[model samples]
Target chain A: MTPLVVGTSAIKRATTPELVFAVVRDALIAHAHDRTTVPPPLHLQFPDADGDCHVKAGWVTDTPGFAVKIATGFYRNPAAGLPTNHGLVCAVSARTGEINAILDDQGLLTAWRTAAAGALATHAMARPGAATLAVFGTGEQARLQVEWLARLRPIDTVLVHGRSKDKTRSLCEAFDALGHHARPALADEAAAADMIITTTPAPTPVLQARHVRAGAHVTGIGTDMPHKNELPPALFARAALIATDDHRQCLDHGDFGHAVRAGVTTDTSDTPVGLLLERPVERPDGAITVADLTGVGALDAALAAAVLRELAS
Target chain B: MTPLVVGTSAIKRATTPELVFAVVRDALIAHAHDRTTVPPPLHLQFPDADGDCHVKAGWVTDTPGFAVKIATGFYRNPAAGLPTNHGLVCAVSARTGEINAILDDQGLLTAWRTAAAGALATHAMARPGAATLAVFGTGEQARLQVEWLARLRPIDTVLVHGRSKDKTRSLCEAFDALGHHARPALADEAAAADMIITTTPAPTPVLQARHVRAGAHVTGIGTDMPHKNELPPALFARAALIATDDHRQCLDHGDFGHAVRAGVTTDTSDTPVGLLLERPVERPDGAITVADLTGVGALDAALAAAVLRELAS
Candidate 1:
């Protein structure tokens, strides 16, 4: 039989953020247990067009199949009145090379996976009894990260920080609709919160060491490309433990690369969140812990496996 | 709008091998003139499962758009009563990153492009008044190679050689139906033909220097993988000139790599077939010339453009 195509709507209906969290969480733990493997993503860049395509693939030994994602980002699409991102994921049997399904996700899965990774990291590293959460950015990832993090933690208020006050106010209003009290705040005000999520494309450091509260847990999901760095080098230096979604990737292209380059850290042996999930790290009550979620391929593969299983049933 | 779907039957009925040859020929000559560009193909292999997937993308500057082909080959598929090869070609707009159409050609386009390339090379490199042709291997390529070459040059007979006698005879009979006088022959007889084409996956050389007739033109299409070599290194030494589909690719993985490794010739600056098309090489009356047609991505892109053009019309 030909490979079935799972469209965006079907993908949305088949799995929730919580469900994705569970699958991704388990896959990470499995990877830490040496049960699955994902290689670094292959990037194709057309700098002249401000376009890029990331080809990611992974396999879980315990699952029925694997997935390869073709994700594109046209940074200049907003000027053309089109969506900034488009993606397709192909599921194939791990035992054989039979392709099972092609998911025309339009970057929805990518968004969900990013948000899900945020939630997973927060669940594993966030301080117990954390209440107020701050978000640094007003983009789609900023919104989804807040939504997913809210479901995983108890927070009745969110501190919004944005380069543009209008977008920040809009984000605050969106947060209010979701039954959370949110208000625009300066970088220092947002950084003082118990939990912080950085989700912007800032070329310079937005979250510095001085602004971070002592007992806070900060998640950085912004600095994906070489030019973007959301957190300052000193921020990583101050954290008692730094966890990256994929330690290997962060060492190469993620936020950790910046820190390594600045001479703040010489070691790439920062704990992988996968390993952290398998063996929880004991943090002191006043220690600042940072989680860098640069994203990984296993999340997509696991979610694709879940969707295909749901469709089959 | 959703991407249009063009299936195998549509691809087959919309164009002929001759049309594909024309489109591919013009594209190659244009590329030779530096009017088109194609990136190197990306290959994903599952060695344990004996499956491989090749991703090829290319575009013509003068054409409307570009194409990316996903071609798969599972060597052990016959054990499960499945075909060994499958493929899909995505036609995409060059201006935007939007995928325009997904052609489910099931490797039909791949086959056509390869055969079309053979015809193009033969047209450019064959000695004047060439007649009898010989094909080694009893596979789809063997049959299609004969068909495409018959259209490019004047030939009244074809000699077939294969490891299996029954399959070789079957190939000859199939050729007979195409109105060509074909008969099973040993390696020496087959090699003595006016032109010889090797279309097999033998790890060792199938066509050695001793077998080839002087002044005969040869085309090698089967040694695409790193481990496969169809023609012996000595055969290259006997040729007056050698041309490859892509000079960059041949130097790395094609038959040229083997010859270079065996110390036959250190110079890799062989002329590209595209250049041969644009400026026909003048070979003395008895000088032999060989062309390596290691199926290129441009051929697929050109044919896809033709198919889309036909569909639009």
Candidate 2:
């Protein structure tokens, strides 16, 4: 049988922020409960093209279908009038080994699911009624994180920090256009916000420990690869509570892992983001919290399945 | 751009045995010469459905495109009136990471590539003017091996060995229908043939060293996974020369690795099949030869690119 081919526009039309948040939330909880199977991703680097590709597959126990996704990034693509990312997800039947659908999302689902995960983690780990949000980097993810977070809670202020002043101004304008108070801020100034989210692909620390204030929650979203880091190890030493999406994956490639490798923290001090979603953790007065997210395949599978269900309906 | 979707019938019409042979031959040589990049496959197992899936990707240097392939096998599918294998190949542009086409061949490319590798290895390693061929296993691979090898050289007699008498008879008749003299024979009798090919997914060895003659060539195609072994270590001890498709992959999961683990042979003693294809090896008098094939992803990428090129033209 020919599998249903769902293109990017159709996928976008069929999915909503609420749908993605619910689906990704359930997936994270399922993963924490050990009810999902996600193999280590297959990564391929093309040095000549300044590009790389990642293939990730995951299956939730008792689900009707599984998903195999391919996401690629070519750093020079934007210079050629193309997006830096491209990919598709294949959803297959669990019983018959037949492909059920091909979600040619062009990495849209990846971005949305990642945003939902980050937003969920940030809301779950941060103190109640947190209003000010400081965002690092000025990419699509940075914007998505803010917009998705707005769907969950109220943010009174958004401080945008980026390497390029024009891009930073543009991102702040975008946030302002979305009916939020946004302005460009320096790294040290942004670090003093109520909640912080780092979304840069910088190789070195974008925010140091001393720059951050007490009672702030920082979520690291850009350090999925080994060489890319956004937070300094000294910051983890100050965080009273730390959370990770997946224990093994985050400990191996996440910002949390880098902190452990640097001897600032032990691996056992972190909690699963799923567990935090299930039961909110108690926060100590004047203590900081951090969440290290490397992204999980199970979340992608769940989100793809949810979108396919919506389309089929 | 919407990627072209090429289904099974179109893929078959656009490809020929000759085309596959040439494509796979060049890919093997490129892999041996370090001109190809093939990442280790991503494997997923679903115990509830008794199924597994393998995701492999590859790229040849200076090539126009690369391929990411998914092949699934559900052992229970045949009982439900479905084929045991299903899959598709995604061809992506190397320069921009844009998907060029999706060749939904339903695992046909994988089978054809495996057959081509086996046939090429057998023809190149077998003694000059060898006439008799014995095939172990009564699957599609066994039949394809015979047909593909016939394209490379002549076989005066065909000996078939199978556990099922009915399958064994049917296979022999199939070979006879193709105008090759064929009959059923025992393992010992079949091992004495000039060339032997084992295609069964047996946990234990199917042929022993004592059964094999002094001057014979054996190509193993079933031991791609760790638990599914076809050839015995004793057979490797009898083999004067050993050839592997990819040295690192073969040493990790191929039958050759099993033999090395059993203390039968060292890793360095084996030769790359591509090197042997470029410059045929000199055979010692009364010495046996064996080829261990775990299959290579580079071959899949090359074949998919070739078939896509054919379809486009």
Could you say which candidate leads in DockQ? 2
Against the native complex, each candidate's DockQ, computed on alpha carbons, is: 0.25, 0.70
Give candidates' CA RMSD values in order.
3.5, 1.5
lDDT tens digits, residue span B17-40, model 1: 768888888877776666666666
Q: How many backbone clashes does candidate 1 have?
A: 0
Q: Which ten residues in a row have the lowest lDDT in candidate 1 chain B?
A: B92-101
Candidate 2 local lDDT, B205-227, one digit each (tens): 99887889989999999987888
lDDT of 1 at A261: 86
Judged by whole-model lDDT over C-alpha atoms, candidate 1 comes out at: 0.80
Model 2, residue A264: distance off in Å is 2.6
Model 2 earns a TM-score of 0.97
The true-versus-predicted C-alpha distance at residue B113 of model 1, in Å, is 1.2
User: Candidate 2 - CAPRI tier?
Assistant: medium
